[model samples]
Target chain A: MMSELHINLSESLKSKPASDALGFGKYFSDHMFIMDYSSEDGWHDARIIPYGPISLDPSAMVLHYGQEVFEGMKAYRTPLGEIAMFRPDMNLKRLNNSCERISIPQVDTEFVLEAIAQLVRIDQEWIPDGEENALYIRPFIIATEAALGVRASKQYMLMVILSPVGAYYPEGIHPVSIYVEEQYVRAVRGGTGEAKTSGNYASGIKAQEIAKTKGFSQVLWLDGKQHKYIEEVGSMNVFFKVNGEILTPALTGSILQGVTRDSVITLLREWGYTVVERVISIEELFEASRQGLLEEAFGTGTAAVISPIGSLSWGDKNTEISGGVTGELSQRLYDSITGIQRGKLADPFNWVYTVK
Target chain B: MMSELHINLSESLKSKPASDALGFGKYFSDHMFIMDYSSEDGWHDARIIPYGPISLDPSAMVLHYGQEVFEGMKAYRTPLGEIAMFRPDMNLKRLNNSCERISIPQVDTEFVLEAIAQLVRIDQEWIPDGEENALYIRPFIIATEAALGVRASKQYMLMVILSPVGAYYPEGIHPVSIYVEEQYVRAVRGGTGEAKTSGNYASGIKAQEIAKTKGFSQVLWLDGKQHKYIEEVGSMNVFFKVNGEILTPALTGSILQGVTRDSVITLLREWGYTVVERVISIEELFEASRQGLLEEAFGTGTAAVISPIGSLSWGDKNTEISGGVTGELSQRLYDSITGIQRGKLADPFNWVYTVK
Candidate 1:
């Protein structure tokens, strides 16, 4: 197996202690995993380099065309003082899917997992031990060719950078109010909505800023076709509890297939909950809220785990949901997921992969 | 006015005699104008730097989130060997509009013009002599902050890169085929379609590739809502000649307000053509094609002065336009615009501004 391939480590390494005040994505760990792919070279030259700036041509496609994709996952320092990642294989698969959609070469999943494991093992000292602190791993690929034409780049760079992240919510978790944006749509069918690409997130910044100005945590994106269906929250996959059943928007072509979103669905189903992935229109959500049938609503993602929605306001109309607090099911799901991540609870699905 | 900035020419700056091979955005010149903007200091340290690699943080927002905008214009070498720009103020105004939409700070229009003038004057040797070749200026702004969080960046870099571009068609202007993309939608209402952001072009790269694979020059993008209304053709604004009337899609908040589009409208109006900016649905276009009322269709942008559409393929249907050649009106409009730009005809509208 090529698993024993020598990893040329960068000489210029800057190591940081675990007790340092953790920020979101500012400071990086000493080493980063990199793998380059070309039409002839395929995938080769896998190495661990010091975290630093990347030199790019002024006409690199990523700078002008924004041809890039990224994945966000975390390596947790378990109660046993061992590093564990939650379903990293899912992230690898999803990253390949995104690459395929963008015409980028796909890396072998085994190679990616092994490389990530090696890097995390080397930087295990950077993973924090607190309740919410972990090593945030960002695996991203960018088109690196020095061409100005509007075509697929010949060369690409895939690198993984690790950042020590504190809790997404520094204080105790509180339900957040979201603004229902009727004006801006995040993704449309037959677009790059399903892919975790830079363009998708870049297009939503204006709407997100608008939502923040209107006293909301995030903007609930609607269907691009008619702006009627509840597509997703900007950075998270949305879930709704109606009639004592869990409901989420189906994996339509316009919505990202988030790994956390899928995990929640699987766990809820395994735990004896009616988890249905179907088109949940905004009208249905509002109507259910009016009838008190909507028990809870929350967004799920890697960042916040499960961020409960306290209320939703759209165009001067406001609706309170589930006593404006974390719902019973949401709390339970959060506990179960976090427990599995921290290696406190039994991972029945074998979702946690230990980094060796 | 701080117009006399330091010009640190790069060692790679070799004097290549201006050739007709300047094609669009290729073959950049020696020097580029650059200025930095920070939250503390609004905008300062304006200088002409050597065009070279830009070192960027791996997590820079522009590479990932695509917080970038750009403007495209050309400086023509007049018969008197003097450089002139066509409707530069319009480009500046449109750039500010793009900046406002993308949350980037707008620079002083006069200051930007002065900077461009200085750069053009310094690099006058790179400007081509023939009417077919001109110096294309690309003024772009990118978020340079090394943060990964989704927020407005406090630091930005604005630079104007100069490229000696040849004619769109060096041999001769030929009509091209375009594929009508019924599945993919480029922009929707209240989206960043009107703004010249990198995300907008990034989203179209996949569709462009598909169109190219199907033997088409570009993909005709449809509105995101219904996928019925014609929005644009690649990076250019589209126009249709239906029943002796020039029709273009109205600025419906989702289509780029192309400066070249506006100039064409004025030029056509002056030449006694009924130019109407209204919703031109795809159904009407197909119907007109069937009735032989569709005389010609063309795309307008800074890159290609006017690209004639010879044929359009939608789904399994194919329609020939104007006998697969540039139509009378298309040639007339092209001639008038190029004539005015190259100082071969009367400048009645005072559109050309000489850069002294």
Candidate 2:
């Protein structure tokens, strides 16, 4: 699949950042992957070019119409000193789903996977080995047409850039406070909510900023239709443990299906825990807290495998969850998932794709 | 305000497109206006440089998260061989409102108006002098910070580009067929519908494409919450005349407050017509058609001024509006607005801003 891939290495590679100082998405690797799509050529001229600025026409449709989709994955340095990816196939599938929803052309998944592997191999030395540190992989496509119509662009550019990072949260694995937002809506059914598109993220900044100003680390979004049902926490899929049962919002065409979320659910189910995927309202969760039945809560995504919720608040109601600390189950799930990703634990689910 | 403005003229200008051949947003003028924004320096270093491609880092936030807002207005060559703008202050004011909604920094509207006047003065020849011809001005701001974090950017670039446009619709002045979209939602009450941001436009592409497949010119979006009430017709604000009353959707948070829509309402009210701004449902519209009370229907925006709707369809119901032709009121409104815009009609409302 990479037979036609062209390589253009950087003339002077960037100095690697200290592992301890590597904040999320700050520094880029020396080389990045790029592919172009046109109506005539159909995704031709795949190449690895020097990581640098991309020149775009001022009227490029992506800048004006938000015609873009992105995927976030990571490459980890294993215990044995080999690089591996955690469920990259899932990311590729989700990327295609996003493309279908945004009316952009989908890439061949297998071919794209091979491209990722080749790029990672060339920049393998750039991957950091600090605790919870990995090479953050960002694969995004933008409409590159120089025209200004409302329709989909006939030209597009898909690029994959690698960024070395420490942790998604500034506090690392500590539990964080979340505010339940009722004012601004993120995604609604029949909208671009389920897709991993830029518009969904753009619509979320105001709510997140409000939560931030209120001293919350993230905003727990309610459904757009009624603003009652819990949809997602920040950019991740959320879950709650009440008594002995696990609850997660169903993929009801508005919530993004996170890869780590699926892994968490599967792991819990395999361990004989009952995980329910249904519409969970904020009122029900508040009532559960009032009854002293809400045990643990967390958000799951690629950036943070498991972000435990220490405190939750909405309107005038606020409560500390799990005594404002990471719960036992949250720690265990994080260890198990990260362990599998780092090749330190047994791969019972065949989740890790080792790059040769 | 213009003291700090710097001008860098292009060495060579491209041949202007033939007035008849000018399509929407196809040809760019020789020069464009640009301004950079940083948290520390504020919006500074405003300049007019040769129109060309802009260089952006691969991880620019706008490319990944769609942090962008844009405005659409035109520079018209009036009958007196002078340039004029139609309510540009309104466009700039709305641009600020869009910036607030998207968490982008707001530009000084009065200062930006000077910037637009200077840019148009430099490229005044780009304004085509044909019937319904104007220099389409697109002013947009994009987040330029090159980072992968899902947050507001600290750096941004605001740009103004000019394109000689003939008409928004290829069919020109004819009534268009509209599909009442129920399966795909454009916006909900708490969404970014009222803002002139990129995400809203991106979310509408799929529905528009589907409508095109069904032989419709555009999609008439229903409310996201119920998918019952009419929100917008294509990208424009919609209006209907039923039983001698002019009706348009109210300025709900989810509907764009178009400058042209406001103008039409004012003109109708001045003509002693009772114009009602309230919620109008698709069921009510169909019932009006059934009872022979449905009259003229059209969409209003900066692009088309007034686009007459000939036929509308939803589910199994299809009806011809105004006997499948342009309504008398629609034509009269279009003529009155365009005449005022072209300096043929008396400026009773002081809507035209003459550019020196």
List the global CA lDDT of all models: 0.84, 0.94
lDDT tens digits by residue: candidate 1, B1-356: 65445667667667775485556566777888988899999777889877788888887878767788888898988887778898999999998998888888888888888898888888888887666788888888888888777777889988888888777655445789999998877777867888888777767877888898888989999888788889999888999999999999999998989888998999899889999999988888999999999999999988788989999988888899999999988888889888888777889999999988
Give the best candidate by TM-score: 2
DockQ of each: 0.65, 0.89
By TM-score, how accurate is candidate 1? 0.96
Best DockQ goes to which candidate? 2
True contacts kept of 1: 0.64
Candidate 2 residues B1-356, lDDT tens each?
A: 78999999999989999999888998999999999999999999999999999999999999999999999999988878888999999999999999999999999998888999989999999999788788999999999998899999999999999999988986678899999999899889888999988989989999999999999999999998999899999889999999999999998899998999999999999999999999999999999999999999999998999999999998999999999999999999999999998888998999999998
lDDT tens digits by residue: candidate 2, A187-233: 99999999999989988999899899989999999999999999999
In model 1, the runs with Cα more than 4 Å from the true position are A1-20, B169-172
